[model samples]
Structure formats: C-alpha cells, structure tokens
Target: MNLIGKKIKIRNFDENDLGQFLELVQDKNNHKLAGLEYTNDIEFGRDLLDMYRRRDGSYTVALQDNNKMIGIIELNKRGESTELLLTREIGFVIDKKFRNQGYAKEAVQLMLEYGFNDLQLTEVWASTEKDNLAPQKLLERLEFKYIYEADQTLPYTGQHNLVKYYLLKK
Candidate 1:
C-alpha cells in the first residue's frame, strides 16, 4: 500500500532503504521522546528488515519531495483474533529535519485509514510520553481520545511516565 499527502509519500520499506533507515534510527534528536539512542549496528537494521517482511504488519518509509526517507510508520496487530473485530497499535517516528511539517500526522492518518478500512480493525491505539506534545497533539488532531495515564519506562533510555490514546472507528 502507498499513501501520498502534501509533500510526502508513504511506501513499503525496501532493502535500498537500509542506509537512510539506519541513519534515521541512529539520530538521537529524532528519537528523544521515544527514548532511543544512537547506534551503528547493521544487525538492528537487519532485524527491522525482517519485521518489514511480516504479513501481520508493515514498515513504511515516508519519502519527501526529493524522495529521501524522512520518517517511518508502523501498524501492527496487538493480538490474534479469528473474528473480524480486532485492535491494532500504531507507531511513527519522523526525522528531526522534517519535523514540524505535519508529515507524521499525515502518515498516521493514512495508517488509521488502512487499519480501519483495509485491515478491518475495530480500534487503533497509540501512546506517547506525557511530555511529548507533538504526538499528543497529532493524535488529538486525528480525533483520538485521551484514554488513561500510565507509568511506563522505556527500556532503552529509561524514560518514564506516559499517556495513552485510543481511536475507535465508527
């Protein structure tokens, strides 16, 4: 699936995307709220490539006007459900240089559409650090309701305190 909006396009991740993907993931500023640190390991990239090949979810790259990868969006099922009703979790990370441009919001909107329509999900949910205003505002703009607060710690950076959001498809 492909999702285009404004000056960005979301497409499936390719092996060719390895270089840019690695750079993005290694960016500390871009992953501040996510509590991720810089890394230069090829194994991390390979693991991500493997995840991209799974049918249960997707790893999409957000391309800019110059066709450079500026972000990534993922939609994954939280559990196995034989019935049509199911729930999914959504996540996104945008490059620091491309932030404040609404690309993450657009990418997430497209993911929600795919989750509700294509994947036939009953609800989609996401969580962010309580202090992360960008994602909180983005989720609100997408009509996701503030669900509850949880004390969570990032295993990577050890950041704690989080707020969760939920969006139910009508």
Candidate 2:
C-alpha cells in the first residue's frame, strides 16, 4: 500500500529500503529519541523487515520528489474483539535531518486518514515522551484529546519514559 501527500509518501517496506532503514536505526542519537534500536549488521536489518511485513503495519515515509525514505511509521492494533478492535496505537519517527519541516505532520495526517477510513477504526492513539513538545503540539493541532500521563516501559526499547497519551476519534 502507498499513501501520497503533497510533500511525502508512505509505502510498504521493500528490500531496497534497507540502506535508508539501516541509517535510521543505526544512528544512536536518533533511536535514543525514538526509543527503539537494532543491531548494526546488514542481515539483521533484512530480517527485521521480514518480521514487519508479516504484520503489514510498519511503513516507510519518503520524499515524493526522490522517493528517498526519511522516516518510519506504524499503527498497531490495540486489541482483537468487538469494540476494542477499532482502536490502535500509532507511532513514528522522522530522520533528524528532515524534522521540523512539516514532513512528519503530513505523514501523520495521511496515517490518521487511513486508520479512520480504510481500517474503519474508531480511534487512533499515540503517546509521546512528556518532554517532546513537538509531537504533543502536533497531536493537539490535529485535534487529539488528551487522555492522561504515566510512566510506561516502551515495549521495544525497554526504556521507562514519562509519557503523555492522546487519542483521536473518528
């Protein structure tokens, strides 16, 4: 699947995306802010993509002009039955170099549309580190309602971060 926007596009991960994907994960500073990581081995990167494809939830955000990947985004189903199935958790991270220039915002808008329209979701939720004002402002700008704040162990990173949660309903 591919999502096109004025400045960026979101698409399924391809083997060719490995180079840019590695750059994003291997950069220590970037993953520290994002709260995730991967090993430096090239083979490990390919293996991880295979796992991502099995779930078909993770995707790449790239420039429309050059098709160069600049970020990753995902929507993880929160539950499996009845009303719970319509809710999902969303997350994303743009390469540090491409941040603050509106790409992340556009990518998120596209995802929100997909979640509410294509997926028929009732709500999409997100949590950002309490100190990360950029995403908090973006979530508010997009009309997500504040839920609460708490200390949560990031599943992938295992880091305990003070998190502020928000949700957008369809």
Candidate 3:
C-alpha cells in the first residue's frame, strides 16, 4: 500500500526503481547528504536496497501520477546496547534533481504520520552533519526541536563527526 500525498506517494521499493535509485546514489552531494560513502557499483545499490528493506520503516517516495521514484525515506530503530529505550530515527535523501522542491517535506510529513500514529510512537528523531543546514531547516519547519550538537559516529554511516540532533514528539 502507498501513503498518499497531494503529488506523491510513499511505497515499498521495487527492482524497477534501480535506475533512479542508482542516479541518486551516484550524485555526489546527495550521497554525501545521506552520509554514505561514494560508490558507483551496482552491487552497492543492491546492498543499499536490502538494508532499506530491513529497516523498521523504509519507503520510496514517488510521483503519484507516474510512479516515478523521487526519493527514499526511512525510520530505523535506534537505542542503547541494552535493548531498552529504543527510539526511532528518521532519515531521507531526495533525488538531486528533486531537491528544493516540496516533495521531501511532503514525504517526511507522510512518514511522520505513520511513525507517530500508525506505529504508535511517541517521538521521532533525526540528525545530520553540522554543515547540513538544509535538513536542519526542514526539520525546524516541521516543528522538530533542536536538540544538542555532538561528535559521534553516525550510526548508520559509521563516520565520526560533529552532528546536530532534532526531535519531535507526538
């Protein structure tokens, strides 16, 4: 099933989306924004798709009228090693050509609804590099409160860096 939006829908990814997915993964800026190591291999794309599928929530944001994949969004469970106090962290990356458009905002709104209401979550979290202000502003627009800045290995990316955190409570 697809989460409907005015001009987009969020749905599970399929093999046919590989081309557009590759395009996104190949774009230097987008790839970096997603905190991924640069790579052009199809195998890495396959691995990424598998990883996305295994997350708590993962969906492709596509055009409602044409089903063209425009971006990807996910909510993955994060917590301490004790298996308690698990939290859900949101992440997204838009196709380079689609940046600055409203698609990412709409898609994130859809995902937040799912995370908060459907998933019965109390809060959703997000983080980005200190230099990534676009995402910071986007989160602020969505009413996410700025948390604190910290230096740590971005869990998903395995990279150590300064990062800013944000949180929104339902």
Candidate 4:
C-alpha cells in the first residue's frame, strides 16, 4: 500500500519502521492525546506486527525525500463485519518533531483520495477529542462537515469526549 502525496508517502508497515514507531508511541503526550496505551519497544513491535498481519486499513506515513517514518494513518471499519466496507473512520498521528509542517494534512488528503477513489467509499468520518484543534482544523480545511459530538470518556485522557467529523464522496 503505497500512497503518494505532495510531500508525504503512505506506505505499508515493515520491520524497518520499528525504531521510529517505538519513538512515536513512547511519547507521553502523543500517546495520551491519541488514546494509546504506553508500551515498550518490544510490545509495540509485536502489536505492529499483529496489526499488519490483520491489514484491515493501516498505513505508515513517511517523508518522501528521505523515506523517514514520521507517523501513521488508518481508515478503520465501523465493525468487524466485512459487509460494512464503504464507510470508514480516518485516524492519524504525526510525530511531535514533525507537527505544524503540513505533513498530516497532505497525508490525509492522499488517504481521502484512496478511500473515495480506490476503495469506492461512500463516506469517511473522523473523531477528535474536544481539546484537539489540529485535527479539527484539518477536517474543516478538507471540507468535512461537522457531524456531532459525543460524550464519552477517553480511557487514556479521561478528561474529554470526542467530536465526530464526516465527509461524503464528491
């Protein structure tokens, strides 16, 4: 799964991405904000391998110039059922060092194209914590209409609920 954007490339996960994947998931701030549990490199690597084998809808986001692993983006299914394929949830996490560089936006645009064009998806949705402005802005910039906000505690943050955003194929 290789997706080329203007500045970022969404590629399949591999062993070579282990080091950077650990670094991204290890950050206390990043993990907490993204609702990810803290884990050591070994556990993280194992989880990555397991998810890759599953191959539901995961991709490694990297820089195109040097092919450096910087983040991850995924289009997840609403349920385990294969029948529900057209509607997926988009999720992403950018490296702290790479934030504010427009990488996340570019990566998302590429994924949106893949979802609507290649996958023939009818709609795509994303949820962000109330306090998370970056993703909200990204979704808005991409013309994803505001759906609604749900009140549910985040296990990792335990502070705020989530706001869902939606976009239809155009």
lDDT, each prediction: 0.72, 0.86, 0.84, 0.81
Candidate 4 lDDT, 3-47, residue by residue in tens? 988788999888888788888767777766665445766786678
Candidate 1 local lDDT, 11-66, one digit each (tens): 87777777777877687665667543356687976676556655446556566566
Give candidate 3 regions above 4 Å deviation. Answer: 80-86, 153-160
- TM-score, one value per model: 0.80, 0.89, 0.87, 0.86
Candidate 2 runs further than 4 Å off: 153-159
Question: Which candidate ranks first by lDDT, i.e. highest?
Answer: 2
Task: Assess candidate 2 and give its lDDT.
Answer: 0.86
Deviation from native of the Cα of residue 68 in model 2, angstroms:
1.0
Q: Which ranges in model 1 have alpha carbons more than 4 Å from their true place?
A: 35-38, 53-55, 64-66, 81-85, 153-161
Instruction: By TM-score, rank the candidates, best first.
Output: 2, 3, 4, 1
Worst lDDT 10-window in candidate 1: 52-61
Best prediction by TM-score = 2
Clashing pairs in 2: none
State residue 36's C-alpha deviation in candidate 2, in Å. 2.6
21-126 per-residue lDDT for model 3 (tens digits): 8888787887566775456989998787777656557789999999999988888777655442445899898887888989989999998988777877778889
